[model samples]
Target: MTPRTPAPGSVTEATCTRCQILKPAAAFYANPLTRKGLHSRCIECMKDVGALRREVPKTTAAEATCNVCGWLKPSSEFHVNRRRFNGLTNRCRACAQDYYQAKRRGIIEYQRQHRWEDARVRMASDARRRDRKHGRESDIKAKDIVIPRACPVTGKPIYHGYGVRMAWSPCLERIDKSKGFVKGNWRVVSWEAVEASGWQLTRT
Candidate 1:
């Protein structure tokens, strides 16, 4: 038999397939792909079904399949997820690690490519890291540091960028390596001045 199609904007009522009861169309969730443009089951029935599915324990053997890589591996290879009855993630450890590493590399590359846009932020971050690494009670404030328009030593205009080599970029220098990144202990100096002073910037 052909299904009765309700006129548009007049679907005030529908039937829940799960509960086998007539109910308001608003009780069902919208589903554009369905014929009626609404779920056959009411929202309450759907919620009950979801709760039942969550309660049902998943069966797992000593080996499990990684949903991502489609590879069968030992259950120990997956991370634990309390929500799952099997207590293991669908993705194996190797696949999860690879995914995270790729995500991290992409972020690093993005930051490196946009370094010029965030030079001042990077300078402050570096200072804070240095302070923490040295166990110093000093703080680095972006507002406190003044970037000079020109190199203090050479009287040349200062430049800031990611691709700009250290020899031409603005650099944060510590007057004394033993000192922390305190207000009086650090200075914004050109990389050329640092090299002229026989000091090389240390890689963190």
Candidate 2:
């Protein structure tokens, strides 16, 4: 007797209205407005139509050319951009991801290089480092250090974050050479002030 049911891939196959390629019905998107309840074109062909309608070459109308890689790939490989005529970004998703990652790294580096560190934090860290270098570790924390707007010793304005120490840059120094980072013995002063007062600099 003849088989009662049709074999798979023989029936229920869909032909994309735009690409005109025969594909499985599962390839199309559900569309309540259509009689067949599915989009006329397959998912890829629907994306390709968006690019082709933007005045791209007809020969490659079914695919979009990545502006970065210059490779012709299915439009699905690109990210959507409502501002663009083609509704897709110039670069494919892979290339776009790489570009964004690099951009994020640059932004982080710029922030690190340009943003000011807290004056108290800088002084406190330097004190700890100096103490360690001289075999004299202290219990001083970052909060224990206080940085004033102007140097008390020389009465000069202190500046921060020009990427390097300036004459007006703040410096952490001991009020007495015999005391090393002792509570109430250390003060923030301008680099120039430290020089004028003949104070011993914190040796590395």
Candidate 3:
């Protein structure tokens, strides 16, 4: 893979493929495979990369940083989150649990104050995100979600309850599970009805 000899009065400089910067031929490592007989990256760029690799501990290179504890921990300690570049959550499991509980309290209070009609305000983003994650089509919005006074399946009153008493709690159901939350494709039903229908809690 010998490079052709440079012509007389040939250019003495070439651009780095990595940094896209023009530098002297001496600034690059020899590469017989390339037409210019030089490496793709400049010597300085290669050195910087090698230095960074040396600085990071090999055993902890795949570890993630916890947003709450400000500590580097094993990536397994973080929940899987497709939204992040690293495919893991920013906070550790303990911190994420605490944050979820706090957010749940706020959501419950808001729903209570709004008589549950405003549950859509909190779920609109979740619906949109779920559609994108599952690669489904949807045009649903916060205003499109309407909570009924009674469950469509069980004909029971709709209200929130704790633990096993959540049977009567109102939950959204997609008539076509393969499809997204589009208009006329979903309804409000009781959790008990969902259980009887062989369905589990979703869109949460």
Q: How many residue pairs clash in each candidate?
A: 0, 0, 0
User: For each candidate, what is the lDDT?
Assistant: 0.76, 0.72, 0.74
- Kindly list the per-residue Cα lDDT of model 2 for residues 1-204, writing each as its tens digit: 111232364345578887789976667776657666667778888777766676543232345789999998997898767556666778999999999999999998777544435666777787887887787646666777656778887787777777787888888877666657768777778889777866555444
TM-score for each of the candidates? 0.40, 0.49, 0.39
lDDT, candidate 1, at 63:
77
* lDDT score for residue 202 of model 1: 36
Instruction: Give the per-residue Cα lDDT of candidate 2 at 133.
Output: 76
Q: What lDDT tens digits, residue by residue, belong to model 1 across residues 1-204?
A: 123345577677889999899987767787777877778888889889989778845655577899999998998898877577676788899999999999999998887646644777778888888678768756777767777878887777777664656666877887767767777877887888878876644322
Q: List the residue pairs that clash in candidate 3.
A: none
- Backbone clashes in model 2, listed as residue pairs: none
Regions of candidate 1 where Cα sits further than 4 Å from its true position: 1-16, 19-47, 53-61, 84-87, 117-189, 192-204
Q: Which is better, 2 or 3, measured by TM-score?
A: 2
Across 10-67, the per-residue lDDT of candidate 3 in tens digits comes to: 5467898778999877777777777777878888888888876556332323678998
Question: Which numbered prediction scores highest in lDDT against the true structure?
Answer: 1
Who is ahead in TM-score, 1 or 3? 1
Q: Summing lDDT over every window of 10 consecutive residues in candidate 1, give the lowest-scoring window.
A: 1-10
Off by over 4 Å in 3: 1-115, 161-165, 200-204
Error of 1 at 18 (Å): 2.2
- C-alpha RMSD (angstroms) for model 1: 14.1
